[model samples]
Target: MSCAIKTKNDHIHTPRDFRGGRHVFVNGNEIRYVIYADTKKGIVKYHPHPVRLKKGSDVVYTRTLKGLVTVEFIK
Candidate 1:
């Protein structure tokens, strides 16, 4: 799946600004981020990176139908 960061009202952007690292945090939870290698000209199939869930983070992560992961922190 791919990721898009919602910066402003009409300025949504892809995650290309982030390099290779799990340093992409949405709501205090870090997500595993990777630039899909098949993003060239005419690739159909995308081999997503292996999903490695954080073992014991106090956050609830949920996957949506639109290929985006949303995180809700536990209080």
Candidate 2:
């Protein structure tokens, strides 16, 4: 599955334009944007939503320089 993004696929090396929004397909589905952030570590966030994977646990990860922002789908 793939999300519909206006960005050019060949422009992967360029920095993402924050002013422009992009679509992200997760787990073969086009999920909504829960949150976005830029940090040395991976994307992280918290919400009142329910996550079947964690069973109501905080999700965290270390992000790399491959992409401009690292996003975490919190439950």
Candidate 3:
């Protein structure tokens, strides 16, 4: 399987992205599913939503290099 992520393929992602030995096929593609394995397993559907601030909401925004932005908040 192919992936379009900036992180390395060997990077470990916890929980949902686990490392195991499993095989799945989709659209004539041979996917090698493994625990935290770097493959197309990261592919997921996207939900379109707008970012909005509500009343009594607390958030902090940080600007990083290359104009990247990070938002930190607590529930």
lDDT of each: 0.32, 0.35, 0.31
TM-score, predicted candidate 2 vs. hidden true structure: 0.25
List the lowest-lDDT window of 10 residues for candidate 2. 62-71
**Model 1 / residue 17 / CA error / Å:** 6.6
Candidate with top lDDT is 2
Instruction: Give a tens-digit lDDT track for model 2, residues 9-61.
Output: 32321124443454433333333433433334323232223433444655543
User: Which order, best to worst by lDDT?
Assistant: 2, 1, 3
Q: Write the per-residue lDDT of candidate 1 for residues 1-75, one digit (tens) a residue.
A: 657545433122234533322232333434444233222221121213554455698433334222333332233
In terms of TM-score, the best-performing candidate is 2
Q: Which pairs clash in the backbone of model 3?
A: 18-35, 18-36, 19-35, 19-36, 20-34, 20-35
Q: Which stretches of candidate 3 lie over 4 Å from their true place?
A: 1-19, 33-75
Worst-scoring 10-residue span by lDDT in model 3: 63-72
TM-score of each: 0.22, 0.25, 0.17
lDDT of 3 by residue, 1-75 (tens): 665345564433323643433343224343332122222343312111332344567532221121111221122
Q: Cα lDDT for residue 55, model 2? A: 45
Worst ten in a row by lDDT for model 1: 38-47
Task: Check candidate 1 and list the clashing pairs.
Answer: none
